[model samples]
Target: MVGNNHIRSVKNVRVKGIACAVPAHVAEVTSLTDAFGAENLNKIRSSTGVERRHVVSSECSSDLCVAAAERLISDLNIDRSTIDTLIFVSQTHDFTLPATACILQERLNLPMHAAAFDIALGCSGYTYGLWVAGSLLSGGGSQRALLLVGDTISKIVSPADRSVAALFGDAGSATILEHDPSAPDMPFVMGTDGRGAKNLIVPSGGFRDRHGQSTETSEPGVRGPYDLYMNGAEIFAFTLARVPALVKALHEANTASGKEIDHYVFHQANRFMLEHLVKRMKLPPEKVVLDVKDVGNTSCASIPLALSLHQNKAGSHLSGRFMLAGFGVGYSWAGCIADFDNVWVSSLTVTSNSETEGEM
Candidate 1:
């Protein structure tokens, strides 16, 4: 059931570079002790493994993504005119009318001929973006693609809500995928179940519930209809039931091709959940990346952000057969086994606006 019609393989596409950026503002989880009490805050911190996270005051997800894209374009010395495809993936877009990708294309100085569009997704968006971009390139229409993924979940979460406020952060990333004749094929497995839609969603703000918005606390100190509501138990159960199968299908497909995965970089959902997955799958702990201590679950930006952070911390480039999986937020899950050969991953950049503030 996991691999019948959901598996896809794209060839002649290679990732050229990746860059990530976060806001300059930092929010400590323990600073909420007055709202949730010391014991509750401690419990949340220990379980989620989130000590602090970067947040945005006036900046949106697009701002952070533009900062990252600017850095990536500069670092790789990529010609702006050569990028013919622009894919911006996120749940929080700049506007509901004009696509944010169009604005990004103009801001990044990409050619007007570039095909720009937006993908409304979260958590599994990075892998999904890669799939779409790779397909576009491999199909012969596009030669180079720029995929931007990010989310500012903090803007949606109620500050007083302990369930989500302490578990989410803001981040953005840009990844370049170009056509390469000698690059190995990238196999991907993706699945989705809309039954778990309400389990993690904003109850209002869309067309279905446009007039149902409310800022009043729905529960005592909890979120409202317009805010993000996550049924944690349901999400955990869904991940347990779905993600393992997704990973299994990806592994089987890769192994059939006589290739082994060198690293596992899953969506940095949380510390406890990632640790549990690693143990249950019997994967090598050293090969898996579990770095959610500083930046909390960043939705779509998590995967690319993790790769950039890992490469910077190791003080070297990432070159290997990498297995990247992203699961959550839509009850959507995707995993890909790709060969990364000296992929250019820039160091983590922190920004307040257009200029780099510092590194976190």
Candidate 2:
């Protein structure tokens, strides 16, 4: 059932506006030394390169996503009624039954004809979201689509587990996809490995193991069944074993079609692994984008967050032909190359409202 080579090509769809929103609270990595020994803290910081992360106390993923989408719509002056599709990608949804996309449709005030749904995914979600949104708009009926991606991972990771607590952060990002015949053809490659699902997962709370009993112990550094469990070593090994080859395959396909990638953006997982990937692929470090230092790993929001945060930095490639990759979580990964010609890339917007009242 795992498709390791699923390539998709979509036409007449172009990325329009990009925006990101993060919680106001700052959680510095050094502050965690008190909770998790100083030695362990330093080792993590050195390897992860996460100096700070934005975490929310009471805010939910829906709140952050709505904030980001509203800003993107307003900043771009987009006609709300014209949008015909809305897709929300996240693992942390508001409810188990009603899809968060339906809630967003009402909150965003889209037209009655608009179709909305949710995609439950994590780190690899942004690229997948882009592909889905673009494909939906390319169907000739829907002219515009909104992709909202993020996760309030802080709410899932056990506060006692330093592994996840020190690495994960919360962020919501918005990307607009519109129909444009003149736009470049977007080429994509996606894959999945179900065998590694347990390597990074929350084992309980789902119907798979109902009973509601505690599956994890109170080990100081270890996580329990109710907490986020990540086998860092396995993840690193998978990243090294899979990501480079995935990038190479996608690059060859894009280049073969006469496309020149001016920049590259990979999922902001961490520093050590990213550096190793770059070296293994033998790609020039200057072309690769890395912005995880300040925001930590924002899951699906990492790519869009990096695009929004580093737009002003020198050599930042928010335009031209760019290769984008998102990996991890569900043991899934996806890559694509697209042109941002005539697209409006917005600056990063930080919102601190923290209001979870279901309205802005």
Candidate 3:
């Protein structure tokens, strides 16, 4: 039997604002024709709908996230001391020894009494972060929380590897969650299937394989064991098998509450995959957000990044019932149905590599 697919709701928590940041260095698909060939590059662009991606040089995921957090705090005019909790969610953290969230607390100038930590998750991280932050506020202690999510996935992907090189970009996002007695419940459905872990993973670099040096011969354009390895077929199959059930559960919960989802924002894995999901689920294309053409797949940051970009392009604040889902990496998946009322979404900001150096 499938477990961990039930919907749980958190009450008395509301999102205040969201902001996203990307590196200033843009890498166009056309510039990669030399590595992937003209014909192959054209096919990639057509299938993935990715023309260009913002990349980072000498920048960590924390840098982008910090920039986004600063923008969000400034836009919202939030007092740093009022933020009682900080959660940094990302697979690409600044350092392995010290949790990036701890450093971020000091960098963002959050109060020392605030609870801070990190969640080392990838694609499903943003939803997971929201679930945790909302739950924290609902239980009564933290009045405000900062949910920072993003990934510099380009750092792990080999430039010559066509599988993911042209399909991923670097990005970070910050979301403010506050406790409000009048807010509606946020329902979430989350699950994990470890069986498909190896299908999308880096073979080494962790404690399991410290050096990341293996005797096995590497693929043509692939780097050593530290680089990302993705079995596209398995990932597609996993999504087809698992995500529909997740969405269905959320839909049922929303319907039971006498509401309907106004928008569906799934993780921006790729254009083809998203289009396939839209068709399979019989969802209205107009209500779905597909903004990955310029930014590519941003892993944990995709959902909020898409939301910010969509709202900016529309030149209006996003309000109403929304369904957000994130699946992939660790074979994990999560979906949330929430009611947002004129929430603040900042325009996408561009940060340079030098900004991350030294103190904030």
Best by TM-score: 1
- Candidate 1 lDDT over 226-307, as tens digits, reads 8898889999999998888888888888777776788999999998899999999999999999888889999999999999
lDDT of 3 by residue, 1-360 (tens): 124467789999999999999998889989889998999999999988999998898889999999999988998899999999999999998887699999999999999999999998999999999999999999778899999999999999998888888999999999999999899999899999999898888878788778877534247556668888888999999999988889988887777688778999999999999999999999999999998888999999999999998898775477989999999999999889989998998878888875632211
Q: Clashes in model 1: which pairs?
A: none
TM-score of each: 0.97, 0.93, 0.96
Ordered by TM-score, highest first, the candidates read 1, 3, 2
The alpha-carbon lDDT assigned to residue 51 of candidate 2 equals: 94
Off by over 4 Å in 2: 1-4, 214-221, 314-317, 353-360
Candidate 2 or 3, higher lDDT?
A: 3
What value does the lDDT take at residue 42 in candidate 3? Answer: 95
Global Cα lDDT for candidate 2: 0.84
TM-score of 1: 0.97
**What TM-score does model 3 achieve against the real structure?**
0.96
